[model samples]
Target chain A: MVIEKIKESRFTPDVFDITTFGTAFADHMLLSWYKDGKWSEPIIKPYGKLDFTPAISVGHYGQGIFEGMKAYKGETGDVYLFRPDKNLERLNKSAERLDMPQIPEEIFMDGLKALIDLDRQWVPSTYGMSLYLRPVMFATEEAITARSSNEYLFAILTAVAPNYYNKPLSVKVADRYSRAANGGVGFAKAAGNYAGSFYPTHLAREEGYDQVIWTDDATHTFIEEAGTMNVFVRINDKLITAPTSERILDGVTRRSMIELAKAEGIDVEVRKVTVEEMHTAHKNGQLKEVFGVGTAVVVNNYVAVGYASERLELEDLPETESYGKILKKKLVDLQMGISEDPFGWRLKVEENLVEA
Target chain B: MVIEKIKESRFTPDVFDITTFGTAFADHMLLSWYKDGKWSEPIIKPYGKLDFTPAISVGHYGQGIFEGMKAYKGETGDVYLFRPDKNLERLNKSAERLDMPQIPEEIFMDGLKALIDLDRQWVPSTYGMSLYLRPVMFATEEAITARSSNEYLFAILTAVAPNYYNKPLSVKVADRYSRAANGGVGFAKAAGNYAGSFYPTHLAREEGYDQVIWTDDATHTFIEEAGTMNVFVRINDKLITAPTSERILDGVTRRSMIELAKAEGIDVEVRKVTVEEMHTAHKNGQLKEVFGVGTAVVVNNYVAVGYASERLELEDLPETESYGKILKKKLVDLQMGISEDPFGWRLKVEENLVEA
Candidate 1:
């Protein structure tokens, strides 16, 4: 591995804001090239522009995939990553679906740990703040053919993320626009999946909704995802979410939350939740809460859902009485190294991984 | 517009092969930038590499769209483009669906004409050859957030294309995988739509098939597309194809073929085509021919279709009796300037478009 450190530090965690969460980055980034069926030596260099041909495959064919993760700074000044292995595993799964090459475990793990350790100061020590990590891979071959490229680029970027104090959202249930098909790349974190949702999400925002709750493409009858996150609904003290399928992403935070909720003696059901059922539950005064879970925002509670011509507002609950709030606190505490991690989800960053 | 002419020419059309069709390029390419709520001056520059950040929105979120076109060299050394206006219109439609900025008609038309005229020497005069044009647009902003980019890049690239003599394809009818869904971006020429089909097509290739015939996402009950092309079926003396919908691409060549076939007094039906109906037609010896139409290949005949352990071989028809062959010859003749165009689809290139 080659290490090209930045000449000067640009680590300004104090000024980091949520609005520009991913705009600001750490001083260093990790890059690797795939060519001739093998990966080149990984390099950690200054975070800056790259030189490539405009004809690169990803620009025209969209063969790109990415993963989202974060490293938390504990009160003891130690940096830790939560479920980095899961992110890596999901990245390879996305690569397989997009017909791109798989990244080796050593390269992913060693490169990530080394990069994070090198820029450990960027991991903000402020309460409820952490460093957001973006691991992305894209086809780099300069060709115009509608096929997979022989060359690829894998990169990792880090940014200081602000504390997310998300307000309850008003979401629109999709009746026309579809996010993913039954046999599609939705399960994989493919770049195209996210881009395809932007126009629809824009429309939802125009309708005075914070985000869109994507439903099945075939009939638009059941909820699949809420924007880019996995959605969960609580009705009469029972939590239910759509089962992970080819049309739904298998989110790390979603699975963790499911386990955490089950551990707390809450009834958790992993099954398809239909829009009609939610509307009926709301009408019967049984719908308690609805929320989305993802790496960026651990939990975003939804206050209202718009289906057809009706806007069903959920009951407002205090933080102490809200399951979403309770679960997010428990998850955040474990991630920040303030609580016991019975699931072994946290991996402490070793400062010795890189040479001083 | 600024013109950065190449110091030397690399017009080697004689040795150009079909396998390296899009790999080689013309002398120059057209580039335009979109920033600050408007487009910058377009430039015609020498074909080369570009400088960009790996954090470009397209590399992470896949906000990319493209169009395929061809410039034919006439017998008298004149250049002609087949329906360039249609391509530009479709490109903007694709842009709108992807939440991208709409490309103005003048920029698209003027830039294309100037670029083709400047590289007119590269247009092959071979009997069955032409110059392939790729107009692609992508999000170029240096950001990692999953939203539409504030900046974009639009480029036009030209390549020497050899004669396409496609053999009869053996396709596998999809019962599991789907290409698009209702209210999706399938009708637009979005980049992600193509990448999502690579894995399924690779699987079909492994099963000794040339391509996979995509079906509807709901139940896979209706055939939608054959590989990346619009599919057609001839049941006895009638030509049938699926209508343009949110789940099917609005192919230019597909529409042209339908018009030409109708002009030749052939009955055409634009409706849904089901796999079961095709099987029934084959069993009754009523299925006559199956073909695919697109910008590339013009027309590709299908010899067999595999569906659920049954490989149904289509009846062989001579070129004289094949409707696809007749329509392709008429279209190619009109495009190559060998025949008088009655449909007014050909646009003659004027040498005065660019300065000497």
Candidate 2:
């Protein structure tokens, strides 16, 4: 591994607003370059701008993929990452979708652990705050032809984020736009999937919604996922969520919540969830809660769901014994070492690398 | 307008290999920056690398759009662009779909004309070659939030290239993977739309095909378009093509071909085309020719098409008096100033800008 130290730390936690989600960056970033069909040793360098030719493939063709996870500063002065291996696996899946290169676990895990150990002080000690880790891979080859790039760049960047959502959200059922089609890259974190969603999500925001509840592209009848998270709706005391398909992301947070629900003896069903079923449940007063699960916000409850001209205001689940609340608490507790890691989801950062 | 001249040319036509598309750039490029809700004055500077922060919005979220066009060096030593105003109009249309700002025609047209005028020396005068111009706009804001970027960069890069495809292509009909869904960014030239297509196209390439013809996202019953072009099939003297909708790009070349067909008194129908109908036509010996229309390749006739486990071999139409050959010749002649422009589609560059 290669390392380059900065002359002085440009940021301190005191001056950096810890509540911001993705603005404040740490001192260094981990980077790896792939060229001539070979991967270089990972390097830790001062965070800065990257030089790019105007014809770089990613800026034009959108051959890019990314992963999101977090590192927590535990009470006992240890940093732990929840299922980093899972994120690494998903990143490679996205890479395959974009026809980009795959990243090995050696560089992904070892480099992350080393970087986190050296910058342990940057991790926020506050309960709500954690270091947000972003792993991004993109094609750097300079061309405009419709083909895969031969050169690539991979980087891991960290920022301090307290929480993504402060209150229950109001979401709109997507009617005019579709997020992912069958046999699409929805299962992968491809950059274009998010790009194609901005306009539709913007329209939903204009209609007084926080995000969009995307539906299957074919029929627009079955519920797919939320903006960037997997969704779950509780009706008649039963947890119902859409099954993972090619049009839906297999989220780590979503899987953890399901495991926690099963452990608590809650009836959870993973299958096709239709908008019509949701409307039927809401009318019968059986729909109790609606929430989304993702790495950014472990569990974000939605207080309302809107479909066309009809609106259904859900019960406020933040202060109740809702499934989302319990799952969030259990996951966070396990992450911060406040509770036992029964599922073996936590990996401790080893402080064995030499200081830069 | 601001102008920055280079000391010497980085490339010359004699040494530039026109066969290798998109690699050899001209001497200068035109660029414009958008910040704080206003566009800057257009600038013409030497073509080179662009400095970008790692957190640029397009790299993470895919807020990018682009346009493809060409400039021809006429026999009379004048440079002509084919309906550049149409490209400008479509660029703004694509921008609106992505929630990005619209570019005024003043900047788009004047900047392109000025750039071509300055670099007119690089325009290929050969019959089969021309100078390809690419206009691209992307979000340059340094943030990761799922919102529109406040900053943008628009650039026009030109490269010399001969015809993209010399031989007739063999394409596959997409059965599992979809290119664009209804009410998605397929109508617009969004970068992510192309990104989501790489994997499917790669799979087709592995099975001995050059491109894939997409189908409707809902039922896969109706045909949409080819990888980057509009599809046209001739059956019993009738030219059948799919109508442009939210799921299909309104290609300039496609529209031009339709007009030419009508001018020649050929019955052209712009309606829904189904895969089943095509197979029936092929079996009945009525499907005479199938071709793709686009700006890159004026008209690319397909030699064969594959769907599922079935293969349909088509005759090479280059020697026949096919509609595709006739349309290609008429369009190229009008572009090169060899024939009269009846539709007023050509824009000649003024020789007022400083030459290199």
Candidate 3:
């Protein structure tokens, strides 16, 4: 690996507002290229613009995939990455599904560690603040033909993020629009999957909802996802969510939340949770909460679900009584190094490891 | 409009092979930008690289759409575009579905004519050759947030093309994978929609088939598309094709062929064509032909179909008896200005229009 360190840092932690997520970037980034059936040596360089031909395959064909992760600064000044391996694993899965080349684990983990260690000061020290890392791979071949490109670019960009302070969400249960098909790329974090949802989400926002709760494409009855995150519906004391299928993303946060809930003695059922069941539970006063889990917000509670012409308003429970709140706190505490490492989910960034 | 002419022409039409297709581009290209709430003035400049941040929204979220068109060199040394308006209409429809800003008609038409006029030498003069035009629009916002971009880049790139000499295709009837969903962006020429099909198409190719005959996502029993083109099945003498739906592309060539067939006194039926029906027709020796129509290949004949464990081999009729050949020749003749434009679909590219 070649390391080209930035001569001067451009980021000012004192003046930067972490809450404005995805706006500010760190001084350095990591890039690797896949060409001629192999990956080039990873390069660490200053964050800047890239020069590409207008006919690059990704621009016209959308053969791109990305992974979202975060790095937290512990109270003792140590930087912690929550399950970086999982991100790398999922990234490869997305690459395979999109017919792009797989990123080597060494290239992903080593490059990620070195870049974060080089820009360690960019990791926000506040309890809920972290560095949001976006690792994206896209076709870089300069061609207009609709085929899998032989050349690819893999890049990792980091931004400072603060705790989300937005209010609980009100989402519309999708009745006509669908996010994924039975055998589609929804299970992968493909760039096109997110692009396909923007218009539907915009329509929902215009209807006074924050986001959309995507349902099955074939039936539109079973819940699949909430916005870009895996959704969970709480009824009475049981937590229910759709099982991971080809049409639903297997989110790291969703998996972590389920484990955290199980360990906390909560009844978590991983099965198909239909919209009809949610409506029935709401009518019977058994539906307690609905939430979405992902890397960005960690867990976002949904206060209302709009289906057809009716809005089912969920009762907002106190923080102590909210399962979403409890699980989020537990997960956050574990991620932030404030709790014992029972699941070995956190990987520390050591200065010595960077040199090695 | 700003015109930055190239200092020297880079194309050598005498030495260039048009059959290579999309490998060589003309010297000049057109570009327009959408920022704030309006489109900037269109610019025609030397075809070159574009500078973009690695975090450009399209690279991560895939808000991209494109249109395919061709400019034919008439026998009298004039240029003509067949159904340019249809391409523009479909492009905007794709843009709307992908949540992109609509390109103005003037920008599309004026830029196309000016660019073609500027690079008139690049147009292949061979009888069966033309200039292929690719107009692509993508999100250019420098952010990783998964939302519709506020800024976009629209560009038109032209390449010399020759007649395709590919052999008749063998296709697989999709059983485990689908190209689109009931309520998805499949009908739009969205970049993501094509990216999602690369894997499934790759699998079909590995199975010794040239392309996939995508079936309905809900049932895998009804045919929707043949590869990226609109498909047609000829049972006896009547041409049958699936109606345009939320899952099938409204192909320009498909529409033209239907009209051409009707004008030739051939019966055409626009309805759902199921796989079982196709199988029964083949067993009864009534399935005369199956073909795909698109802007790229105009029309491609399918010689065989692999479904389940059986391969249904189609008889190759003589060129005179082939419906695809008959309609393709009629359409190509009208496009090349060798025949009368009965439908007024051919638009002459007047030299005066470039000055306007």
Which lDDT tens digits does candidate 1 get at residues B94-154? Answer: 9999999999998899999999999998887776678889999999988877788999999
**10 residues in a row with least lDDT, candidate 2 chain B:** B11-20
Worst 10 residues of 3 chain A by lDDT: A12-21
Report clash pairs, candidate 1: none
For candidate 2, what is the lDDT? 0.85
What docking class should model 1 receive?
medium
Tell me what fraction of the real C-alpha contacts between chains A and B each candidate also makes.
0.74, 0.61, 0.71
Give lDDT tens digits, candidate 3, residues A61-114: 999999999999889999999999999999999998999988999999999999
2 versus 3: better TM-score goes to: 3
Task: Note the residue pairs that clash in candidate 3.
Answer: none
Candidate 1 regions exceeding 4 Å error are A13-18, A163-166, B163-166
The residue-level lDDT of candidate 2 at A44 comes to 89
By the DockQ metric, which is better: model 2 or model 3?
3
Taken over the whole model, the C-alpha lDDT of each candidate is 0.88, 0.85, 0.88
